[model samples]
Target: MSDNSQSAAALVQRYYDAFNAGDVPGMLACLSEDVAHDVNQGGRRTGKALFGEFCAHMERCYREQLTDIVVMPSADGRRAAAEFTVNGTYLSDDDGLPPATGQTYCLPAGTFFDIADGKITRVTTHYNLQDWIAQVTGTGA
Candidate 1:
């Protein structure tokens, strides 16, 4: 990989590190002011304020950590992708998901990022919602 690509990978790695540490401010620091977030199986939200709101809501509903992370950056350093495992516990009821009862779950998830000027401009996350629902509901294999 090129130097720029390595830098992109480092930026993504730092983002995940901040996420694992539950450092919302650190995570936001890696993002551009006008960051765009594409939530898993959900609509897109733009800007740091909205992103912070989303993070707040997530904090209220769940406690999570990412592990087994692997980041891959594009050659030009403009894009990157990461795969990781999410270990989490449902803490409270979310808007449309199942009710929470402190149920713990492990799920594989991935994210794509768009980077520019050393800041993440866009973040898109993906995971299997149905699988998560089943696991939390005691109905999955």
Candidate 2:
């Protein structure tokens, strides 16, 4: 891979590492000052403050463990797709839902990241909501 591609991959890796470690500051350091992050399970967040809020929310709701992180470099070498599973235990309220039963939940998710100048400028994440609801609520249809 080219240098740019390698750099992008590294950034993606750093993001995941920070997430798994629950190091919000480290995660933000890997992002641009004006980042645009879209969490399908949560909501859209722009800039550092909003991103920090999102991170805090996640840290509170789940203890995230990243698994199977596959980073596919984009043709332009400025972006990549990261697919992984987050195995976590619900520890706090989620989306107005009550706290989970303290059972472990595994969620497969993907994030498309845009990197520029060695920092992540954008990130769009995809995940299943119904499964999360069922896991948190301990009931299903």
Candidate 3:
């Protein structure tokens, strides 16, 4: 891989490391000031402040640690993607979702990223919401 690609991978790795550590500030430090976040199965939210809010909301509702992370960066270093397994417990009720009762789940997820000046400018996360719902509701096959 090129040096740029290596750096991009490192940046993504750092972001996940912070996430696994439950270090919100550390994760935010890897983002651009005007970063855009495309919520999984939801609309896009722009700016680091909004991202911080999202993180806070997640913190309140769930406890997650991402494992088996694989980061792939484009040769140009302007984009990247990561795949991981989210091992989590639903801690509190989130809006429009099933009531939380400390249900545990393991879900495979991925995130696409756009990087500039060594900071993430955009983040788009993806996962099967229905599958997650089924798992949490004890309806999964």
Candidate 4:
């Protein structure tokens, strides 16, 4: 484990910490200016500004926290991966999803990151949409 790997791991840890604390500024501080985000079960969105917009939208529609987070960095410090459980409540209606009734769900999720110059350049998140929908809608889907 090189020093750089440790730094990368720390950066990722801080990012999650910021997320848990609902500090959007702190989370953005960990990302590069042109950071790219591959949203869970969705398309790619780039740049910190766009990321902030995405965050705002998420904030409007859902209240979420990540639990049991584990971050693993590559030996070279250019890549990392994280696994966690998303504890969330659907707060408002979102397009292409079941209506929100303040439903609570716990979903397992993962994310991969690309780091450079002590900042995250890319983030790709993964999770099961159907499972989440089923849980939220109570349809056992």
lDDT at 73, model 4: 98
Every model: Cα RMSD to truth: 0.7, 1.7, 0.6, 0.7
As for model 1, its CA RMSD to the true structure in angstroms is: 0.7
User: How well does candidate 3 score on lDDT at residue 24?
Assistant: 95
Each prediction's TM-score versus the true structure: 0.98, 0.90, 0.98, 0.98
Q: Model 4 off-target regions past 4 Å?
A: none
lDDT of each: 0.96, 0.85, 0.96, 0.96
Query: Per-residue alpha-carbon lDDT of model 1 for 54-111, expressed as tens digits?
Result: 9999999999999999999999999999999999999999988899999999999999
What does candidate 2's lDDT look like per residue over 11-116, in tens digits? 8899889888888999999999999998796667889899998888877777879999999877667889999997888887675676666777788989998888
* Model 1 worst lDDT run, 10 consecutive residues: 132-141
Give a tens-digit lDDT track for model 3, residues 33-58: 99999999999999999999999999
Residue 132's lDDT in candidate 4: 98
lDDT of 3 at 34: 96
The whole-model C-alpha lDDT of candidate 1 against the native structure comes to 0.96
Residue 30 deviation, candidate 2, in Å?
A: 0.5
